[model samples]
Target: MDIKLDAAALEAFLRAEFPQVAGEYTVDRLTEDGLVLRMDVAERHLRPGGTVSGPAMFSLADVALYLAILSRIGPQALAVTTNCAIDFMRKPAAEGSMTAEARLLKLGRVLAVGDVLLRSDGQAAPVARASLTYSIPPAA
Candidate 1:
């Protein structure tokens, strides 16, 4: 499949539409197949146990898939999450940043599906995996 937005374009789109989260995530790499997103972890992302919270992990997955969709369809903030399923596989160390590798498995006019694998900055094993579905609203 062809990508409508490249790394630079994706970065700009995120900064413009989602300013609050702009610095939290970055488009490290983008290609014809998928994109690599880096999450800048902060103290707020952790729980009392010094581990990343489920909500934080979920947010990363959601953003990754959403960005993946935008990378193909251009800046479409109307694309919203319709459903999601996430599995927390391993505990993330509270020491470092996390990364989510997301890919668009399918993209259509009304819906998009993708999965994200998340791990600590240097860990090889995934800390979580999320399957997400996005609803693309009709263009105005």
Candidate 2:
């Protein structure tokens, strides 16, 4: 699919449309079929064991997929996640950032499906994986 937004445009869209989470994530790059997003890990994202929390990782995956969809469909803020399933395979590193690589599996007229793999920076293996389905609002 053709990309409607680049990295800079996606970042601007996030800041303008969703300022609450704009600072938490960065658009690392936009690939042909997807994009890579980096989450700046903070103290609040940690669990009791000094590892990244599941919710935080889930947020990363969700936002990554959301942006991936927007990159193709333009800034459609109403596009919502209809279903999501995530698997936490291993513990993430305590320090540094986590990157989520999200790719769209299918982009139909009303629904988009994607998968995301999250890994701690510098790690070779993924810490988590997620599959998500998003409902795209019909054009006005």
lDDT of each: 0.87, 0.96
Error of 2 at 12 (Å): 0.8
Lowest-sum lDDT 10-residue window in model 1: 26-35
- Candidate 2: RMSD over Cα atoms? 0.6
Model 2, residue 41: distance off in Å is 1.0
Model 1 TM-score, 2 decimals: 0.94
Regions of candidate 1 where Cα sits further than 4 Å from its true position: none
Q: Global lDDT for candidate 1?
A: 0.87
TM-score of each predicted structure versus truth: 0.94, 0.98
Ten residues in a row with the worst lDDT in model 2?
25-34
Q: Write the per-residue lDDT of candidate 1 for residues 9-105, one digit (tens) a residue.
A: 8888889998998888877887566688877778999899789999989988998888889888888988999999999998897877888889888
Q: Candidate 1: how many backbone clashes?
A: 0
